[model samples]
Target: MRPVLIAGGGLAGHACALRLIEAGFEVELFELRPFFGGRACSYRLPGYGGSEIDNGQHVLLACCTALLDFYRRLGVEHWIRFHDSYYFLEPGGRLSELRPRKWAGPAALMAGFLALPIFDFRDKWAIVRGLAAVRRQAGDHRLDALSMEQWLERHAQPPRAVERFWRLILLSAANEELDRLSAYHGVRLIWLAFYGAPGAYRLGIPQVPLGSFFAEALWNRYGRLRRHVGQPVDKVLINGGRFHGFEVDRRVVEGSAGVLAVPYHRLAGLVPQLEADFSEWSCSPITNVHLWFDRPVTELPFAALLGRTIQWFFAERGGSYLKVVISASRQWRTWNREQIIQHTLEELKEYLPAVGSTTVAQAHVVKELCATFSPMPNLEARRPGPVTAIPGLFLGGDWTATGWVATMEGAVRSGYQAAEAVIRWLRADRGG
Candidate 1:
């Protein structure tokens, strides 16, 4: 049989290719860039003297089963380092750590949350109640119409509690402000990350560059997959509402099946028949300010900063290099490189005292304008499924209806779902 064509070399495309090959189908994956991993990729800066850095820091929780399974398939599971504790730093360098107690079972997280000094008695009470409400009312369809902020207010969540606890976590998770995020996603995130399993909330950071996870040699293990990097699909060719093949470099590349695994913004151009309204679909930005100091700054591996523009920072190279992350960073959209760096340093000095005396040897700022699609209220209903109107053609992307926000896990789930749809379609066509 001709190979199944997969467009986009992101997690979704990679996942689809692997699954199709496992199901006894030849797969051909095309990527526009010379490298793979899509947004979750790494590249060396032109004048950085061969120092490789990710486009953005991509972290996963233990609840990301699909993404982990994908890593296991590539034999790179060991490349990720899981952290048990989450450090939170206040403006004056006050430290608060949240880590589950050994053998405490499901109550471990709750116990840890209660022990945090960041939340006062009233704040803790409000958060505990809010979590209980999330457990009871997570999947209710009515929650989709209301914003997470409104839901929090209706539940009598204190302003301090909302700002210090809920907003910090959900904004980074959903990549949007509470007022713009849907309560359905917010509540679901709480359950998935906190209640899915005992170790569900443990953070996993990649020990190696993100691009290394999808190296060509690793993918070559699957003989059925034919990877075509730096090759962009020009168009999706369909005949009488049936998938034909993809047009690349002004030539038709025929395939048994095709999966449009690109971003939502690029979907209409590929398959115009879908006629989906993308006008309402919007994206959120994330900013990463890389600061390399002359000496080690913070001893901690990673920490979440409170009451500041910088949300989180991950220390690398023995704390000499810090990757400061600003999720939902629409505020910095207008700031220049110098402005971002100066402001990040000012904030870092307050949290990490060592930054006040250290000199920044180098600094680089990366602003991902379209880091993720905003999970706004009522937007979930518009997300498409794997099956499309055209036969032998499927859609695979994190923006699709994967029951999760635009995370690595959602991307892999979409790919697996699309591959499953193709398996059923081709099997029925052959009467197998």
Candidate 2:
């Protein structure tokens, strides 16, 4: 049996390897990094009672079926705890909760609107109308051309409501602001969160470190597969329009097929044939300031922030560890660690007045300059599929055309799809 080569050991690559191994194929995975989990990896923080902290806080939704399925398959479904209600905290000390009701169908939908504390009568009407518009244009392609802000403005959405409420919702979900995000993507997010299930707005956070939940679980499942770490592939070796293998550390590693699962910017140099248009697929930065407080600030697991410097905050179990995720944090990316910590601490104090005079036990800053691709207009065109022009080569990354932004679920889905493509190609070649 010819071994299938997988380039890059991120979520996509690992997922593909697991699937291929299950399908009766030997696999060899090459990863540049010494560890896995890609941008979603975890690190130990000195504070937080010596608990592990993620690079940034990532929340999964009920609609994340692929990721949930992956967790279940890996036998780590219990590592995630789901919340039936989500709280949106405004800086002015106002809180809104989106809770699920037992009512079925549209009744449940109406219940969510009525239960939300952010919307008034007019705002509720506007949301209903916006949802109607979304359902009406489900099949239209023009939604991709307009930004979410433009779409809402055209519908006479109030500036205050859009800025204070709608923008926050979109930013948290899409990881991009409405002014720049595509209306289609924004609408898709709303559709999935609202219409998917009775309590679709429910949120889920990992109970354990992200690395333990994902990478370790995957390794345990496919630990015996040929694995190489700290060895980055320089380029994909092509001979006569066929992918022969790859060059790692100036040494050639030959294989029958390969999956390039590295990030976008690194792809062009590795595979010159890959015509990835990064212009449309711009990256959005995510900054997470992990703070350990002597006492808990809020009992709520996670809360959204509005009218405050802090965009979102989550309280972990070990201690009052609050993670502030500033999406599209391009400006703050280059700030020195101290400066970043100072600014974030100031913002945190403003949100939780009780922590105003309290001394910080510990603090750390984690920033991902290219955390995920901004889902802007025309981004759909920039993302390609798993199967590339090369006969024995494939692409698998969240940035691919997975219809999902740079997410764990998207990465896993891309890997699953790529593995299926490789399996189909192998079976065809054998005339099976």
Top model number, lDDT: 1
Model 2 TM-score is: 0.94
* Alpha carbon lDDT at 247, candidate 2: 93
Residue ranges of candidate 1 with Cα displaced over 4 Å:
none
Q: Residue by residue across 164-257, what tens digits does model 2's lDDT show?
A: 6568778888788788888888888777776766566668888778778545435655744788878899999999998889999999888778
- lDDT tens digits, residue span 336-382, model 1: 99999999999999999999999999999999999899999999999
The lDDT values for all models are: 0.92, 0.80
Model 1 local distance difference test score = 0.92
lDDT for model 2, on a 0 to 1 scale?
0.80
What's the number of clashes in each of the models?
0, 0
